[model samples]
Target: MPSDYHHGVRVIEILDGVRPIRTVETGVVGVVGTAPDADPEVFPLDEAVLIIGSRTKAAKLDTTGNGQGTLPGVMDAIFDQIAPLIVVVRVEDVEDENEQISKILGTVDATGHHSGLQALLTAKTSLGIKPRILGAPGFSHHQPVADELGIKAEHLRAFAYVDSPATTVEEAVVHRNLFGNKRVMIMWPAFKVWDTPLADYVYQPASARALGMRAKLDNDIGWHKTISNIVINGVSGLTADVSWELQNPVTDAGYLNANEITTMVVQDGFRFWGSRTCSGDPMFAFESAVRTGDVLADTIGEAHMWAVDKPMSPTLIQNIMDGVNSKFRELKNFSYIVNAECYLDPELNSVESLASGKLWLNYDYSPVPPLEQLGFRAKLTNKYLVELLEVK
Candidate 1:
């Protein structure tokens, strides 16, 4: 908007300096599953549907037919903790479990049509907000289903909460070996909840509460906090009793956590007992760390449209750096990160690259990993005894 053609000299205010970087919203849960009793008009098959916490809207997914559908049950679990914006992708439910899983995994046709979990890819466009926590509660225990969750999570830059087929600690460890991806969370030993229609106690997958609790954590605390040690709701008890002692690694809960499997333990109440991702790398060992990195990257990627196609001026470069560093500083002040810095590397921003309209900005950060363990060295010393006597 240069007004240079005017005869009268008009001062055009030039906006300069730090541009605000808007962060992508977190805590939105995206899920793919089947719902036999769900209303077609409300939740059509192979489509992404947005469902807020309206009982009337949620009641459309009725369970009067053949049991409560996977989506209904999963949503119930999530609602127990906190109301969240959920994107649901309902697939065709059939008698054959394998065939149903195939539908859940979905397909991308030559026509660019997406089905099943693939529908999640279109959520941001259709629903206006993408899901940050991904899962398929009843079916995610299968290897193919969990693998699909992983693929969708990486594409969406989200976290995958998966249930393990393992009913015991050792078996859960076997399932843990199957995954090394940082975004994948391994949960075991489904919790038991009351089934109103069936009039009995039914075991719900670990994903039932994991997804809800993650949303609560992202909302209550920052994305850097791990989803462990939080009291779980809407569950009577765990299907199996996993032992726990604060300092006892020999306990089943301790053993499971050591192998990167998250399970429910009966403490003050039923609480999640682990803070690990199924990552072999030490850097991304914790789920909180991986999420911190993802949230930061996604937020930065979605922001900065105004900077695009602008001339490669020193002022533009400084503006970009200042904006990003502003977000980093905010995250640090909120305790999401220990510390961070954004800088343009001179070596990476070479003359050839800048001439070609390519710029590389590097940001280094340390995510606040949860305190998984703490220890103290103790010794029977005469010095401590003397101090106690003198103090008395």
Candidate 2:
């Protein structure tokens, strides 16, 4: 429903390149119809099919030597029952009409739902009728049009952007209230987390157990358990973990038996959040895709323990940190966050103008000092320094 056409295309492309992805079909399919005469259903559906058939047959003399095919009569009955999915656009509004159609098709591309239609069209093209294209999300009126064209409606996978309807005014109000002009990036992992020293040190036992259960479900349902990452631009971003509870009562009941077991699992959820500001840059328009790619790269790097098999060159990280800090300062508004321990590193301290009033987190690690605790110091991490001309 939302503009997801490009994303769907990307998904299919990536999966096709990597491996043969198997997916179970879910939900209902959409219908289609096409017509040249005035139709009622086409009034609402802009992306509906419009088939312009010819009625005049070619002369026998023309066909005798040229092998010309006879033209078939155009049927007016095609418009009778097939609703307004295929509207007769006036020649005058061709530009506006095409723009709307393009937008819908673009949405389909963004969401990765165009594969079925693409396949259908490919098949139809092989038979000689120049394949007419449809948008990713199928509307109710389009079913008959598809039928008239002899294209199977089942080839379409109908999926709306927002599935759940708002039941209460409060829910709607809350949803609207939280909306803002910002960008968001959502991420899903590619592999499951089994064992890692970082998990042992950073996460609690309860957290580890929850991850284990998730991995198990991923295995059962044939979904990958790898953790994903995301990065958002055009708006300041915030990160948080989210989850949703889903269960099937019938399958859940079977768990009570000794031999039968069931686990009511919660699906992990992630959402990129930003305000909806019209003035935001084009990056905001592509925040979802950009962030997804960034996060995926980050997740892969993180999983590899930052080693990445590359030589232990700190140059890239150092350069990124330096560049980000420099840009933050140049912006003259946003505050820069820095880890103080990084400053003490011999490589960073020597750079001229590097130590300016940027915030820092204090950390100390030394084998010689036995009594002094070595970690982030409250003096640095907890305090902020106004930007001054000098580092001190």
User: Can you write out model 2's per-residue Cα lDDT over 109-206, one digit (the tens) per residue?
Assistant: 56443322333333233322222112221111122222222222223211111101122323322332222222211111111222221232221111
The ten-residue window of minimal lDDT in model 2 covers 67-76
TM-score of 2: 0.17
How many backbone clashes are present in model 2?
49
Each candidate's TM vs. the true structure? 0.95, 0.17
CA deviation > 4 Å runs, candidate 2: 1-310, 314-317, 327-392
Scored by lDDT, model 2 comes in at 0.23
- Tens digit per residue, CA lDDT, model 1, 320-375: 99999999999888898999999989999889998899999999999998888898
Candidate 1 segments exceeding 4 Å error? 1-6, 63-67, 381-392
- Point to the candidate with the largest TM-score: 1
